[model samples]
Target: MLRNAASLSVTVTALVLSAACSDDGREASASASQPTGVSTAPATDATGGTTDAAPTSSGTATSEPTTATSATATASTDDPVAPKFDIGGKDLGASTTGEGDGCKKVDFLFVIDNSASMEDNQAALIASFPGFIDAIKTTLSEVTDYHIMVVDSDADGRCEQPCVMDNDYQEFCSPKNFHACNANLTECDTTRGAGVIHPVGLYSSNKKCQVFGGNRYMLPEDPDLLATFACVAQVGTAGHPSERPMNGMQAAVSEALNAPDGCNAGFLRDDAILVITILTDDPHYEDEGTPAEWKASVVAAKNGDETAVVIAGLIPKPDLGCAGNGMTQGAHWQEFVDSWGDHGISGSICEPDYAPFFQQAVAVIDETCDNFNPPG
Candidate 1:
């Protein structure tokens, strides 16, 4: 099921500080409540398999700024050519706008949990992704530049083991032994926080997925976006049992990983609107820091413009009876999503189809792009 926080009773008052950047002159607020009258229904998947459908919910909340200060732009006396905005104490010149006031570039980050219980979730994400991107391309027609990257929850990339032994007794790790293993022993796997182009664990294809450039992430010019994305997004189910999505997200956009020589170099852009989508059934109890601190890390990465980031996720919502089997409620994840107000979207991981949630997220992403004032 899909629920937007705006439908709830929470009121968020945003103070738009700049007139030049506030074309819509609107503020966004949202909060979530447990849905009532819940009932279980069998939902069929693309493969004809049946799964439980989430409870019916209202439409998604409209995207808007929360209590946080919106981005502002001021005329620069030093340079007469363009205006400058102070982002995280650094003055960045404004980029030339398109036909209307909207961001020309967008960066999409997908954080996927690769634990033992994520096989179905990963397949669902891979199956639903083409339509999601197609919707974005159609709805946000002006956005021609894009950077899409995927990262797994574990930073170590080691596989869980009791290694599988061959006829000669040589041991190795594979998807067959993913559930049978108890300790992390296989070291040759995809690195966490780095954009995945070559996944090597559990159910991974274990082949290098090529993009337009030799970069780790996918660009708009990639020859086969669907195929490449599917290859890397299938991170498999051999990651550390204790998932750390927040840490992976923070590290993915951190300066260390975005550096010229880093594994995820050139994935993040200062002038682009950032949209992060996390897919996981784990509660992430092992992840460090509070929701506020995690939000701060992302905002800081985006030059401190909270409005430039959009957080969306398919997580366990136990309160609504939408959590997967053996999955606890993701309290921290829920709080993190709520902290973004309208910019945040949370969906139940138990849903039979993730397409609807992703489709709803497009509206929020479009609004964010419309209001984004890119740094020059």
Candidate 2:
């Protein structure tokens, strides 16, 4: 449950009395007693109105009033207006210590959109990656074991046109030109072609790689973590123009479950927290299945313990408005996040900097870990 610090306001009243006196030190009585006055202005500083000098009256004081004004005033310290740890105007729900035997492990799957328009977003994410890791480490003392993997948002099942080896990461084709003639060249697929970089192939297909000593886990302590992430994350613009990130994620997880000695076989642990973060600017294709189905796929992969999963997203937010350039309100992405309750957090993908997003995500993860109910 969420805890709040309450500020208490107490009102204290002090009685003051004054009278006019003669030169002989005898009281010069007034016709009648003046009414008592009270200052109700709130103190604005920590000194509690003590620092400023008090005003003096010309009349000499004889004795204080015997009749004291007795009144008690109490102001609620609880902020009825705002919460301290709010994100994008939404108050985070009552936190729960996630189900686990301590926060020993975490499995992070980043489904990055590697389309034509995601270059800047990708750069921001990469630059902020270290901060995210630092936050996890800072909170947990040390994360016992964590696996990080990347998959691009392209699961269209159709090969992109004229696929070839243009980039250095292209293991799909060789250096030699497959299509060439006296002018009018016809581009053709090599033996591996489209499937080589496909999400399914990287995780579930027979062509799945044994990059980590015949397994798919990439440790946080990996010597070349950034380069490795960048390699897989840069899926390039050669993929089909229409993206299916939900389908891609589903395929990746499904492959991890079914493939023989699959890349993701040992990554998902029984006690580990699973964080699946999607970075996309477009909406999920309707043909890729609804958000419910995708969520179910994740739950199933995590052994039906919904407490073991956190699905965060960095996509376009509504009010900030992704107005320019053929962008929707990211309603479909928001729909996916809404289904997860406190298990999900969504931030704007249009921000030029992703540091705040990373920090908040890390903080959320830390809070989730703190709420986890460890086994006996």
Candidate 3:
């Protein structure tokens, strides 16, 4: 159960009395008569005017006729209010201790949309990743083993047409040929749901990416994690315009892809907590299957243990002013994220800086890691 801080309100009432001087300049007696009993009826003042008795803190009426000089009411709320820690908010919660005896290995899968108009969003994600991983390392100190993989939303390989690879293994497309190609071009259909080691599509880096142990994913032992991630995560903008992020994510962790000779082999571990982060400006309408089914596939990858999975996304949230550039609201993605309850978090993809969003995600991930029970 999610815990929320309670709000407190205080009310203070002060009474003041004035003492008048006599004609002889001697100070008059400043003592005021006290009420003998609690008043249930209206009390009449010296001027014959009836005034309603004031209620004390205990909700009982007092017969005192004293004047109320001032009344102050103050209301204070805790730092993280109920809405702050809500399902899809930017401020989820504070950092957790992560001291529970749970799964210590974490697997992170990034499903990034490589469609047009995603250059800035991809750049923001890459720029914010270093700090995000650092915070994770500090907060989840026990988690020393990690597997990070990046995959594009295009499973059909729409950019393969009108584009060809040069002798140097560089992708050369019409009007953009002779330019630097940083992607690793492969059989179009083979990239379906495969971990992107060298992104080979339009708007890509056009450079080959080398991972430690020649694996498709990144491990903790990989030297210069930031540099390697920057290379592989630059899945350029020349993908299928109809983004299918859900399909990509589902296939990335599917049993076929994680087999011994599969593309994403050894990426998913039974004793590790799974964290899937989706970055896209498009909705999930282009993807196959419903949000419930997508979630089931992910949970199934973790041996049908839903508690061991966490989902976060930076998508178009119209309510949060995150809709623009032909980016409609992400109702399907929102439902998917909401399905995870506290283990899910969604942020506005239009946010100029993604640092805060990733920072807030750490709190949700930390809580999920605390209670994660690996399947024996």
Clashing pairs in 3: 181-206, 182-205, 182-206, 182-207, 183-206, 183-207
The best candidate by lDDT is 3
Instruction: Show model 1 residue runs off by greater than 4 Å.
Output: 1-100, 157-172, 175-190, 324-328
Error of 3 at 128 (Å): 0.4
lDDT of 2 by residue, 101-165 (tens): 45667888887765444544566566556545654565455466787766666642222334433
Clashing pairs in 2: 7-77, 97-371, 97-372, 98-371, 98-372
**Per-model C-alpha RMSD:** 16.9, 24.7, 22.9
Best-to-worst ranking by lDDT: 3, 1, 2
Whole-model alpha-carbon lDDT for candidate 3: 0.61
The total number of steric clashes, by the backbone 3 Å criterion, in model 3 comes to 6
- Once fitted onto the true fold, the runs of candidate 3 whose alpha carbons sit more than 4 angstroms away are 1-100, 161-184, 187-189, 324-328
State how far residue 123 of model 1 sits from its true place (Å): 0.8
lDDT of 3 by residue, 89-155 (tens): 2223533444446667999999998775566567767876875787677667678999999998976
Q: What lDDT score is found at residue 312 in candidate 3?
A: 75
Query: What TM-score does model 1 achieve against the real structure?
Result: 0.68
Tell me the whole-model lDDT of each prediction, alpha carbons only. Answer: 0.61, 0.46, 0.61
